[model samples]
Target chain A: MITLNIIGSGNVAQHLISVFQQTENVVLQQIFARKREAVSHLVADAEIVTNFNDLKPANVTIISVTDGAIAEVSNALPYENQLVVHTSGSMGFETLSNKNRKGVFYPLQTFSKAKAVNFKEIPICLETEKEEDFALLERLAQSISDKVFKIGAAQRQSLHVAAVFSCNFVNHLYQLGHEICEEHNVPFDILFPLIDETADKIKTLSPKEAQTGPAIRHDQKTIEKHLAFLDDENKKAIYRLLTQSIQKNNG
Target chain B: MITLNIIGSGNVAQHLISVFQQTENVVLQQIFARKREAVSHLVADAEIVTNFNDLKPANVTIISVTDGAIAEVSNALPYENQLVVHTSGSMGFETLSNKNRKGVFYPLQTFSKAKAVNFKEIPICLETEKEEDFALLERLAQSISDKVFKIGAAQRQSLHVAAVFSCNFVNHLYQLGHEICEEHNVPFDILFPLIDETADKIKTLSPKEAQTGPAIRHDQKTIEKHLAFLDDENKKAIYRLLTQSIQKNNG
Candidate 1:
């Protein structure tokens, strides 16, 4: 059995630990968190540690921490010979350099602590410096998921950038729509079907092929009318900018 | 088996035909289209009628024509006392006035012939002038989907407005992201996970709770940096608007 150790107790760590515990070959040897009280549930099952010195000897040490703390945590870890991995889409694998073996086990899915992750379905993105060691991470990933991808650091960075544009920014747009409905005494539930369908289409069609709206058709009349409906100055600004951007892409 | 007569051969009609066939009780009886070529598919399996006089006596008559022609098509229908319904989210049930029995069988979903709809999941909004007719319509809707709502014409209109903001507007944002990626020579495939995850989050988390980005953090520096990346006059305007909008919400 391959001994797996997880460091951190945030959303990613919790999700990762849950998946690791499920697998037959992969055993979660230990889990670490500074605030043990914060992760009381995790401490009960696994050999939980707050000190880096208390980390058990394991084949793999996966660090699931915030983006800013990645470098510091990589340096602070006691393990020198173990296969060290960080579950970050944005940060490079070299961020944990001088470590015997380093890699990335990024799951390209947005996770909330309260939400249970379906690791078997979510795509596991794997990357490593050494070609020979890639298979270990890849095999470990495939055990939990069928949608594992052998992505490089550069492609991963591009993925991160694209994610910000689509997930983070696109979500902000959903909030705007919700705000618009609330202001107009309209229930946001009306938009639920439309939003669900839009996402559903992308499974079969590309985002480019699935695109539709006034901006796509260059329907300036409707666009002008919609722009007039905006009461907030910033809302109007966003409406104008997005409208213009869509029109530019129309041709 | 309940006989279903469709009075249009547009996207909604085609989709309804495909779905109704899978359903246990409903049977697609006849399809009416203005053009013979348009009704070719319906003619293969079911009765096809071009003239209103050729309409068959069925349990239900669903008019799925363009919004502008809903009244005209309903007027031309040769039903004496059958359940007459138009599948429109915006148009009121009264559009089929003069007819003794009328209702709106508005499926709260965007229908494209290419996309297959899971009728059981999408909410079908129904409304009628007569209480009995409304109940019948609601029951019929329940046969197709559990997510049925007895929405008034005004509420339907409001829902359509929200749909525009959520579906149509959100799609425009996807295109904007695609354009930005294309301009940067980055493959748009990278954004798929993010887009999928963003939509999936709402299934569990509310838009307000699921929201995350530079805008929410009030990270003006990153927002300004991202804006600089998009040198287009209009793109800059959109960034500023969304940033301000998010900051306002967070505050």
Candidate 2:
């Protein structure tokens, strides 16, 4: 059985802890959190470690902390030459202290405190400094998830940026849509099916193939009408820029 | 039975014909298409009308042509004072010829020739020039869709703009994300679950509440890193503008 110790108590950390506890052949050996109460509801007091020095050696020590604190947490680990990984998409595993055998165990899925995602579907991205540590990380990843990839640091950074566009920026667009609906006294939920289908269409067709509406069509009349309809300058600018970008890319 | 005639053979027209054919208490009396081959695969030659003058009287005639052609098609209809509706989201029923009673039967979802959507879940936004024609249009809408709203012309225009942001712009973002993934040698499918969950999250939470990532947190470091990673000038500008917009709206 593979034993694991998780550090931090943020959304990612808590989610990892919960999934690990449920997955067979994996044991949550301990959890190191600065605030014990942050994870008290998730684990017993015996499994909680408030100090980094109190962390026990496990098959893998996951530093699921903030990006800024990942280096500090790795440095503070009392043990050396152990498997230390961070669950960060943007940052590389090199940020961890070199004293430990460093690797990355980033889960390529957004985690919210309220939503419990199916662990089996999440793509676990793994990176190791040494080839020897690859097997164990892959095994741990496979135990919880059906999809796993050994992506390098450079590729991971690119994937993270792509995600910012697809997930983060897409959500921002939804917010803008919501603002428009609210200002016009229309219910935002009316757009739910359209939004859902837009995301779904890409599953069967490429985004380019699935693309519709004025921007891609370059329907100047409808474009001008939409621009005139918008009252917010920021939204108007966004509409123009994205429209131009779509035309340029697809033109 | 409520007799229906659909004028046009485009994506929206074909989808409406298919759904209306399957819906109970509705008969597709005749379909007016300039090109018979466009819809002959779905319906028999006897049911198709190439000439607008050959159209028979039905309870309602749906003009599902392109936005530019809606007015022309409506004006060409041989009958007068019949219940006529167009399915263009941006344009109002006013675009229809004055000879017929005008109404809007816009299904607020994207349609592709290849993808068959669940019509029951699609929101059909209805508007009529006269209140007397409301019941027949409402009946037609409710026959195929569970979600129906009596949205006015002005409100429908706002919803159309909102849909551009939520659906069209959102899909363009997906295209950008796909480009990034292709350039990085990472399988774009790896980001599918994240995209699905992002869309799903907003169903329960407002878009503002469901927002995540660097821009929402104002993580300047990650934001800068992403901006620098984007080699395309247009993409970089988009990242900066969208980031600024998110911060401005939320802050």
Q: Which stretches of candidate 2 lie over 4 Å from their true place?
A: none
Docking class of 1: acceptable
A1-251: candidate 1 lDDT, tens digit per residue: 77888888877788787778778788878888888875666443578889988886788888888766777887887768678889987667887847658999998777777667677777778998788889889888888887888888766765554565667767777777777777666667656767888867866765667765556656565566566656667666666776666666666
TM-score of chain B of each: 0.89, 0.96
Clashing pairs in 1: none
Best DockQ among the predictions, by candidate number: 2
Report the alpha-carbon TM-score of model 2 versus the true structure: 0.97
lDDT of 2 by residue, B155-216 (tens): 99999999999999999999999999999899999999999999999888888988888898
Q: Which candidate leads in lDDT? A: 2
Per-model TM against the reference: 0.78, 0.97
The CA lDDT at A49 in model 2 is 84
Docking class of 2: high
Model 2, range A1-251, lDDT digits (tens) per residue?
99889999988999998888888898889999999899989884338989888987888999998788899999999988889999988898889998899999989887787778898999989999999999999999999999999999999999999999999999999999999999989999999999999999999999998888888877888999999989889999999999999999899
